[model samples]
Target: MTTVLERSPGSEAPPPSSSPLTTDARGRRRKATDVTMRVLVTAAFLVALIPLISLLYEVISRGVRMLSWEFLSTDMQGVFGDMTSGGILHALLGTVQITALATLISAPIGLLAAIYLVEYGKGRLARVLTFFVDVMTGIPSIVAGLFAVALFALLVGPDYRSGLMGAIALSVLMIPVVVRSCEEMLKLVPNELREAAYALGVPKWLTIVKVVLRTSLAGIVTSIVLAIARVIGETAPLLLTVGIVTQVNTNMLDGRVATLPVFAYSQYSQDALGVGADRAWGAAFVLIVLIMLLNLVARFISRRFSIAER
Candidate 1:
């Protein structure tokens, strides 16, 4: 009878009630933390947006009226006037060519370097490569230009200024950015996946080629686009190396290139501010649009590729 005092098999005592003041204090603290976090996030976003908003406002206010097809399509060869002047066609073309060439050179090297760093690299050489990449990252754009100028002086003589030189300088600037970005993206691919590929008896090279690269291809492409954007607006390198011209020169190996940034600099530096200033603003507008388009295209491509992977 003493052992037959029935009790529920799994039931437990209820948790003790917390004091009302303590409960209220905890609730208030949670609310306060939430409010503080919201305030901080809002402030951070505003701070981030202010510069971009200001730039867009200024560019639009000054250059909206100049946004005609004639202004963008016709080359500003000989025309000069006040507030109503020539176009940025040649500079636009040169900027495109120069950035394209730079991307062509940098993207491959950067992607390969990233692959080696993340996949094949394991020892002191990897560490050295990482250190060098870090140093390159901090090197000024002007220094890259100077390096290109100095290097070319030995090979092509003192008067050697070509779009190819400009591209090489830009490649120097772009490679580090691409390497860092692609390396990060590649690192995000799980070691578990790599191991699974290895478990399946796949060779390391094939695993990297078939699984690693494909998985990270979208990010690699985005990194390439971002690197292109980084160098597209460069002025100093083009100024020192390519030299500016009013006319179009398509050959990257020899002759003056008319990139948008250098074109803007030339226009603004002219003795008079009438037509030159106007054209400079217009070129700036075009450059902005082109960068914007590139970013959009990158996002689109990344999205499409990501969806396809899924």
Candidate 2:
């Protein structure tokens, strides 16, 4: 006997199967969205790149003519008026000396402080120290310069202007940056490594030195380089503390010194239309090159020396 199956009265028709047309439409929408996002991101990148390309073009076009062995070797001691018979030797020397001094002064202190904050710090003291570091990070470069000037003036004399003082000012700026960057880098280290070191009966300090610091060494170096770049181009602080001199003076305490930024400013201010302007542009080009070299060196060091996982 043949039996007829009956459907319930309240039962609705089964849902239709998904169609290829609907699936294709949804895939097309996704593709369209992805394409739109790519276009937007590319447009943004090109817009950001425009200014940098323009700046490089302007600097290179104007400054390339003035860059020479003579421009790199000679000092502006006797080159008076629009003579244009001088180079940035003195400024370059001062920039190197003062920045090196500042690094020497700030690096150890900042690293130690960061270590303390990250490893051993607890409770109210750590909070206070962190707060102070945060405040210092936002302190104006001019204020640091003034503080250095005032400190030296009170200790030595009112008219004391030297590269040492400029170094001190830069140290103030560098310290906060170093501390903050180092703190973040140290924090990025895994706690598992610390625990493993502890499980092996290693002392806390030894573990930090061997495991934590080693793991973060590359980042720490990068942070230090960034701090150097931040302070190297500062004109106001160096101008106030180091002052400008035509001849090279290597003594940090005896007399004024010239830095690239200060020298560029002085040249442009003194002679905007002639040889000085070209010299100023050339100094700027040199400064940019120096920063680029420092970054490259940092990258090399990071790659060569940083701990690698097996």
Candidate 3:
């Protein structure tokens, strides 16, 4: 049986509680623990942020001096070490072309695979594919570069370093990320949307295309952006597959090409106190700016699509 307590008519009401919680010992201990965890989490966040802030500061402070208009439009075709007059136009273009190619190659394949996994996968084949993708995700990037080189060498002679090869290598790194990220995004689409479309007698494929993909379009674009960023900053793969060039070459199937990461690596290779070091820092800054611009583009696309969806 439940027991009830009664209050006397002449007695004053109990004092207001000191907190949202009761003032018992257990409550007090729980509040103390909550405060302790909040303090620790805040401290950890600040600690993690310190390195990022320091890195940005150092890069911007050092790089801004050399990141002039001329520095962005010229290449070191005839210029030698320690001069640092040429721009990185060729390298910049190569980076854009190669990365775009990689994105083109990986995005569709990954998206389709993710669609299959989310919409139709239900058997052992899906599990095996997922396991392999997980394996690929952890594979060292250099291994991808090597595999690309070997594959191309078998088909196109032993000396096969090209922008196309670099893109292929980068695609190997990007596909798994695209698949995983797109899978998560696709999963976020509400089942109600799918069911409602199906109840309207919509074809399964049409429902997925119109309802599922459209609903998750924003997240899909964001995932692509993430995949691009993840691969754009990698150096080892490009170094082996793309090599380096001082001249402009827009052809992906042709000779050596330069990219921002490779450009920065080449610049940093010069003597410690030389102008090359400064140029390297500038290249790094430009790279960061390019990434920021790409992110802006992705955000714009997402917002535009979201508005249309609305």
Candidate 4:
């Protein structure tokens, strides 16, 4: 039997393509969102940079003429009525010395405390210590300085202002920061590494020293840099405990000191503007440079440690 093909019923054609207007509307919405995000990002970046740019501009305009080798090298004691005579050398030296001493005093203690809290301590005491640490972190810088001064004075008599006292004040301020940072770093260390060390018959202390600390050394160093940076610019503590002087102070235990912050403060607290203002701007510029250098050093140290870890 021959089968004849049946004729198909009439059928509507497929709907025509969507209008260009619809496509254009979707494209416009996407473009609008993109533009909004770009604008927001640009605004945020500019906001972040405004203060820095303004500061740099102000300092450069006021200080560039006054920033000379003599201005950086000579001390301000004998200089009178002229911005060109005094330099930041003494203050810079004191700043370096005090901050170094403070870091040395704080870093070890804080790191050990963090190790104890993270590795050994358990339950309630750890919690209490942690809470106290948080509280310490919030303590005002001036309060830390006052506490140091009062405590030291009570112990060693009232005539006890020295560079060492300033260091101690800065150390008190730095410890909580170092502790918090180190504790976070230690916590980031994997438990598996500890277990493996234990399985290898290594002692807990050795395991921590060789494994945990090694793994977290970069972070620890970064914490230390942060601690240094935190205290480096502290004016109140140094002002109260160290007692600013124009001369360089090498002895932490004996004499008054001049730090960059104090030096900058003294310059800015002038009776009349003009030259003193110029000196203040110059000192500020120097401080900014010092801080920037420190940040670079921190980055370098972190990167080196990270590479060694790998």
Top-scoring candidate (TM-score): 3
The lDDT for every candidate, in the order shown, is 0.88, 0.94, 0.91, 0.87
lDDT (0-100) at residue 287 of candidate 3?
92
Question: Top lDDT: which candidate number?
Answer: 2
What TM-score quantifies how close candidate 3 is to the native fold? 0.93
Q: Name the better of 2 and 4 by TM-score.
A: 2
Q: Which ten residues in a row have the lowest lDDT in candidate 1?
A: 76-85
Poorly placed runs, candidate 2 (over 4 Å): 1-34
Write out the backbone clash pairs for model 1. Answer: 81-275
lDDT of 1 by residue, 53-161 (tens): 9999887777676789888787767865553556778898899998999888999999999999999898999999999999999998999999999999998899998
182-294: candidate 3 lDDT, tens digit per residue: 99999988899899999999999999899999988999999999999999988999999988888899888989999999988987886556888888888899999989999
* Candidate 4 lowest-lDDT run of ten: 270-279
Candidate 4 TM-score, C-alpha based: 0.86
> Residue-wise lDDT of candidate 2 within 148-225, one digit each (tens)?
989999999988888899999999999999999999999999999999999999999999999999999999999999
Ranking by TM-score: 3, 2, 1, 4
Clashes of each: 1, 0, 1, 0
- Residue 137 lDDT, candidate 3, scale 0-100: 91
Q: Is candidate 1 or candidate 4 better by lDDT?
A: 1
Model 3 Cα shift for residue 76 (angstroms): 0.9
Positional deviation of residue 303's Cα in model 4 after best superposition, in angstroms:
2.0
